[model samples]
Target: MLKNRFNIAASLLAIILSVGFIGAPIGPNNGDPTGGRPTNGRPTDDGPNPKQTIALGDRREIFADRFLIREMKGARLVMHPPRDEGPVMHFDQPWESNAPAYITILKDGDTYRAYYRGGHQRANGKKEDNTCYAESRDGIHWEKPNLGLIEANGSKNNNIILEESPLTHNFTPFLDNNPSAPQNQRFKAIGGTNKTGLLPFASANGKDWKKMQEKAVINEGLLDSQNVAFWSESEQMYVCYFRTWTGGNDRGYRSVSRATSPDFLHWSKPVEMTFGDRPYEHIYTQQTSPYFRAPHIYVAIGSRFVPHRQIATLDQLNELKVDPGQHKGLSEPFLMTSRGGNVYDRTFMEAFIRPAMGLNHWSARTNYPSLNIVPVGDGEMSLYVNQDYAQPTGHLRRYSMRLDGFSSINAPYEGGAVKTKTLTFTGKALEINYSTSAIGEVRIALQDENGKDLPGFSLLDSEQLVGNEVARTVTWNGKTDLSAWAGKPVQLHIYLKDADLYSIRFK
Candidate 1:
């Protein structure tokens, strides 16, 4: 169990509230004039209603705002390789670090099924093509089942998925933003890519798998048929967004190629969607198109340099522009900053997000320019991500909020308590200005008018600590999709019982 145990500090005794000062510019001729254009009827329009107002400090404050530190208590890297104790799997040798692709979860009555790719670097010059499976009763804790499934290497490849040679085709197994796909409902993952050509394969039960076709999906064509499919009911197709490079240049054309099938077989032709800077995006780079899953949107992970790794939804993807280089309504894309760690190759193999913790506690990563999102977990919904600082070794870490004291408009900073005052918010996102000496867990909570807990509102992402509270700001990314806490009086509550919290501001 990956647990975070800490001690609580003594409770504060008194509560205080203080008013935030905002400055309004005093116009001329209101009382004592400086530039009061000699008006006739005793000064016109009350001196133009003061020009602007400046904020002295925060206009509003959150009281009793606690952070609920839900540590990924039992969620650890299930398939991290190069371990000295485990049965040394041949593929995981020279184990610098193992990158994880997508971890999919399936629910069968009371039991749950999981499948994930255990990715490592290509040691001994092996062409990096190995995918495996594991299981758990509760999603958090997992174990490899002794099932005599998937085999490697053969003349035509018998028990293997697919061989990534000049002879066969391979696709990175990246899950499409299809909510209705079997893979989303626990089918096998079959596509995604690395820094090179396409590598594609499929699985039945996620463990016992086989290659779909002996030949590559795209035979030396402009497009590489990587496994980037998403289930679309409107089109009734399993659409895969693939990348096509031309002349081995730094740029390539990106298209959402569709392979339609009633089942996972017997496909249709590819449909192309080119948006953004195709050449720049295709230059040893891979990216996913933007699709709406209601409040949240999904983006794919790839990089031209640094061996192309994974990244989560650090920022909202810009609205897709149908015309490339048109300078339309598209916002600038947010560049993923690599979080440093040593579990994998520092210079290579980065971690990106697959999806939010859904049926199980499985998340994903990539390595060796390899791609594939596998199912993971048995019964948990815990997921952890690392910052891309590109360090090679140490604890794969995440930053969290640290709680401090609170002040109010009615009371001063007597202790850590707040002199209860009602607050109104009319913004989209909330900001938490906090400081931490170290990285740890910090939880936040919210309540309604009747003081009922709002369902499905929690901060599960990494907390990137900037510096001291007075200098840096720790923000809680938008967990709730509502435009703002409008029309509803959402009393903010935070729990730093397990950690520390500074201050919170509603955006």
Candidate 2:
């Protein structure tokens, strides 16, 4: 079986909007209270849910659309903090700050355990690196564990638990990954190193890690050194994901790579992974990192910054825009595939929706979207888009829908939106007709109560439609008897990119 991988490309943006709901109720309908509609005092609950508003608090924030590419012809470059809102933490120190490539969530009884790699960086001109630790009760706010574990260049007082040993700089950590496999009490971690050979350290408790006495877990002898690992049940084997570079570009060296591992021990050689223009076209990028299986799927997050954003305004002033051209990517999320060999290749690529409104750019004020997939129903899931669009202060805006209904990730239509209407009935086929200027595109998928996309039911079919007079007409010719879609509470995902619907008839 092929390895299933999900990558969220870096290019986080913050979006901000200044709007308030006078009378909005914050209650849990299903997933997040933020996924509800607002009450506009019309004797009906047909308004934006006030509870869904995300507050930017004291950081530089923006709307989620900044990096999400919600609009096709929108802005391409979105900064982390919209403006110098004073001390915005877009890119922090200790190199580990940006080293959030992979993360794992462990269920230690009633407590949810999280282990992540703090990337490498020089502190105030120091050569050492460090990894931090934090635990969460509700998986939201985290508290530091007062353990004596510490990594290299880290303070015993700070959240540092394990310092980089002689093996290499301490990296990401993973615990008892294979649940279906034996109940082995195994733990592992991988990262970069300055030593000649043997890197990566494994331990029983995160504190006392032992160096891999065997081959190097991951050592391509290149820069941007980062490695992530996890266990897979489908294949019944352990797997690792990592990145590395090859040569240099106009600005500097250019590297795009990925790799997989069977056991946390011996690692396969690195394989190159590239997207977009010439390798050197984009600058300052990190390999894709892996995340744990919460809702049940191998998730990875990778980041890269377009040098154009970092350039002095007077230099590349013509490249800036309010609506970014996100599709032409230098930075975006993608799906990775693990074939037989050591390298895990990229299957499909798409822009990850930022939890906030805008892109994480340097010039203008911006915010990067925080993203995570949530389970909606048996075969449905919802995308919780927490944005600060409505209020410059920041507010949560939600768009819920099924995961499999749309043909492609870039389907112009979203699952749950103001214009989205839910239709229920019992029949062999489902058809829809609308009245609008043009029906931009059609996305037919199922979703959950929270409007997240489900995994199993992702049967997608898309087509570019032509406009018919003032109203446009589109239909879903069920390839399979969709009678199953009826009576069982299924969602119909219809996107109105360029058209509106006056009436929707199902037959």
Which predicted model would earn the best lDDT? 2
Compose the digit string of candidate 2's lDDT tens values, residues 1-507.
Answer: 122111101101010011111122223331111223322221112222322322211121111111111112111111111111122112232434332323334434444444444445446664444555556554333465666655435544445555453333436566645654333336666655546333556676555566666566566644333444555544456555443444565445444454555665666676665432222322222322222221122333344434334322433323443223221223322223232223322222333433222342332212222233333334333322212111123212223323222112221222111212233455554433322234343334454434443443332332323343212233333243455555543343333333332222233
Tens-digit lDDT string for candidate 1 (428-484):
555554433343333444546443446644222213233344223334443444354
User: Candidate 1: where is the Cα deviation over 4 Å?
Assistant: 1-128, 136-142, 150-204, 210-217, 220-226, 233-235, 246-297, 304-507
- TM-scores of the candidates in the order shown: 0.35, 0.45
- lDDT against true structure, model 1: 0.30
| Shift in Å, residue 97, candidate 1 | 10
Candidate 1: minimum summed lDDT over ten consecutive residues — where? 337-346
The prediction achieving the highest TM-score against the true structure is 2
* Alpha-carbon deviation at 239 in model 2, angstroms: 3.6
Q: Roughly what TM-score does model 2 have, to 2 decimal places?
A: 0.45
* Alpha-carbon local distance difference test for all models: 0.30, 0.35
